[model samples]
Target: MRIPRGLLAFGLLATLSATAFSSEPQWVEVRSPNFSVVTDAGEKRGRDVALHFEQMRSVFGTLMTKANVNLSVPLQIVAFRNTKEMRQFAPLWKGKPTEVAGLFQGGQDRSFIMLDMSIDNPWSVVFHEYAHQLMNGNLEVRTDPWFEEGFAEYFASIEVDNKEARIGKIPDVTYQVLQQSGMMRVADLFRVQQYSKTYNESGDHRNTFYAESSLVVHYLYDNLLLPKLAVYFDLYLNQKKAVEQATQQAFGMSPEQFDKVLRNYLSSGRFKYYPIPTPPAVVPAQFTVTAMPLADAKAVLADIHLHSPDYQEKALAELQEVLLMQPGNAAALRGMGYLYLQRQDLDHAAEYFRQASEHDSKDPRVHYYNALLLNRGSDIAGTDRMAAMKKECEAAIALDPNLADAYALLGFAQVSSREPEKGLEAMKKAVELSPRNEGYQFNLANSYMMNRNMDEAAKIFRELARSNNPEIAARANSELAQAEGYQLAAEGAPEAGSQLAGPSDAQSARASNQGVSVEENGPAPAPVPSSAPVHFVKGKVLAVDCSASPKAVLSILAAGRTRKMYVENSARVIVIGADRFSCDWKNVGVAVNYRDRSDGGGDVVSVELQ
Candidate 1:
């Protein structure tokens, strides 16, 4: 049976203390690029992680000053080289090799936080854990998963740049990916109460809890209901009142009523991804190879004017022709494989990857894709191909050690191959290599949890839950809440900082809407427009896809008239409608937009293509 909730990891750490702590605790150096300790695995990475941490601290300092909010906690985030090694610190299960990173365990009053980094947006993860730090370290209150986890997931999604942090919103990607596919309605997706039982009785619907919490946070923050929400938080923290009480007081309605409104809001959109709708009534997207020579195929890929199950069919068909023209066209083979993978047609993907590998022996993508294909198989070949898959994955890594994707794939292969420890180690390397990608961290956490290494599992979950990007945090907190004693530790992180691009950089970030916003006073250069396309930066409103409702809705931002992606929906307005607004954009609502289908060629710019 699984370990009981509320208490499990403490015993191991307590035991370790009894055996070894005769002196005051000095931070043990892990594999970070920032600081180093005179211990094992304390060479280069410690300093790297420290450098990254310090950078994030500086960024946070500026943001707080700008946002005009004071935190009661000193948030500390850790950057791990990889997932497996992060988990190694926890009490290794029988024969296990690692512990969890990004957990909030062992520290007094839960002052310690840990996280594993493997993404471009490290701040998202940092903010999530930082939220927890504020609750425990500063507030000095008994935080609940329902509130703390939800808030962390909500904040990490808030992105900031050009000295301005964006606030609450959902990711357009969430809408895009599910828009034409099988996705739930916003009401079911955004309802906060879904997380009430993340770790209730007989397990939890982890993903649903996270998605729902993010949606709920989106509705509240989008509608500017946080101050009111705070009142509920106050009551919940002070009297340990149930969410039911908090909800009634906070919204002046029962949870069911609130859920209904949210559901209506989401369903009204008319776009969703899920249950594979009967073949789109119209012709789906198709890539075509209209012309071909002995060594090349004329390939033209069109944007799916509207999403369809066969969105990439034309592209895949063209890729097949390219393979036929030059049986050894590695590029063509690789393209076909990836396309199939996206469609989740593992068999076809494997077929393409296999040929791609044979044609380009040194291409890491080939090996990585091949391994992915092998793993995707649902038959005996898959069950028996572990050794082969590991070899391919290792080969991919060997070709390019910094290929974070390879590291992640290898970790899974290793674990599946029964060398769980080695697999875990590979996962650590994966996180380190890509310290800014979510997929790797997600897989790493899964490995630990599945292996019954709760400490390690819980740690990664904490990092994810406390991310600065809502998507990342939402997913993380949901899983963490379900994991036993996950709130015990958390890793600290620092912002990666930005390299100024142009006048439109801030605008671009707004379009993509990726991370959280913070307060600062520095006069960042006015973002000048360049070839770079705008992206929604989580907190602020930016671009709208051309495919959205064909209304005269202007894309959000400071510009517009031509239905541009960077158009503003409305000026940033603080709740209570006061001047010099300190819009605490700790809640990024969503990420969406389409890019110009032409040059800087195809830099995404549409929330709904015009």
Candidate 2:
């Protein structure tokens, strides 16, 4: 049934009026939207999400579409940075409450797609949700367990993205009604009480909800249901036409006729597949980027012709090859440095950035990014490395005087070097180029405060305080108050005298140790305090002792905990530090792949829960 006219009208008007699905999300002047986005990360995640989706699409297309079901539908996905993000979207769910990730509303033009990036197969959940979205976009008819869920489960049965991959057929829910009660054909079970169901109404079957629906969908796919699906889509979604009319229009038959075929396929209980005799080839464990040959080296360099989307890894890899072939190939060395920096592979990134600087003394991107990678965050490589990186950034900037990124990189370097003045100048220059960049604006304010330029700092802080971003704005307000107090003291009546009375701005700044804004540091949490720990963990898995096998780790299955700390990853090591461990461990890298140790979920991969 349609939503109450009043409610439908109200919901549509409300959602449509709220910011019209941002045209250029990246360019939007994000004032501190909600949570602070991590900086230098340009809508770029450390791992490839879009690639994963494409790989999924490619694999699914190869397997499912070739056999039958043609479920191709264009979809716009909203990938969240993490679960912490919810203020950005309104829930668009129908039926019972959905979990962290799913399609909230399929009926509307812009539906909610929340994928918890923290999960390993976030794409898998996205794949399941897309089935709903696709069905809504294509068929336009509302469906129940036998259709909606069955299709989702069917689509989820595609190959996983691993060298040695396996796919198993399983239902989303256990104890399905068809297997247990043997009542109601999948055809009728799929149809909703056309007049009563809507997004707000909640009703769903526990068993047969997911699994049976999936099996039914698989039947349709195997039995050539794509054309029928297309027909449904054309009739209903395309024209908002009625079901019987759409069925007649697409299949040249009434809806009742299609229902008959659906029954025959489902009841047969036989599935179709060209079974894999052996698992897919698993590549060796050794990690190495493939290299281009000597002849291909020149072609590779030619490939990196500035500003090309198809810039191949070969172009960069070839540079390495060329350097190896002739150690002093300045062009190749410089190219290698450029490519290394491009990938942000800092040590190699630095080597190439250095070569470019040495050969040309002016390439901006090389020096700028090198400085950034070398210094940013924990300084994994150390401060001396950062200084060298920043120095290169400065040289790159000096050579051109208009390198915006170089300025940005230089600003970070200056901050790390305790030279807020130089940092302030660079940050300002960067802002001039990209005025809306949050990181630049943020650093500029910090630089101002460091130089005791509180008035200017407060101005920027006040501006950012009203942004859509919560983290930066919160920090801005707190900083604004500090700046205001500094202003009051600057007017006289304080121990710190004004620099204006003594000498030039630079001289006075140097004398007073000006621009030294810093947060106070306190004691760190000690490991010994684990004694007073409020939460004690159970069923701890010990890392393998003296074992060469990387996967020889013990599985720690504690009761009442979904969060599993990985012994292979850094989690358990830090939590249970080296000092407290009684168990002898092997050469690290041991991870319990699955927590439950069950095979029911059909080739689902699980890492240690935590």
Which ranges of candidate 1 are over 4 A from the true structure? 1-314, 378-383, 446-456, 467-610
- Deviation in Å, model 2, residue 41 alpha carbon: 36
Question: At residue 568, what lDDT does model 1 achieve?
Answer: 23
For all the candidates, what are their Cα RMSDs to the real structure?
29.6, 28.3
Q: Which candidate number maximizes lDDT?
A: 1
The window of 10 residues in a row where model 2 has the poorest summed lDDT is 525-534
TM-scores for all predictions: 0.31, 0.30
Q: What is the RMSD, in Å, between candidate 2 and the native fold over all Cα? A: 28.3
Name the weakest run of 10 consecutive residues (lDDT summed) in model 1. 299-308
What's the C-alpha lDDT at position 231 in model 1?
84
* Candidate 2 Cα deviation (angstroms), residue 544: 27
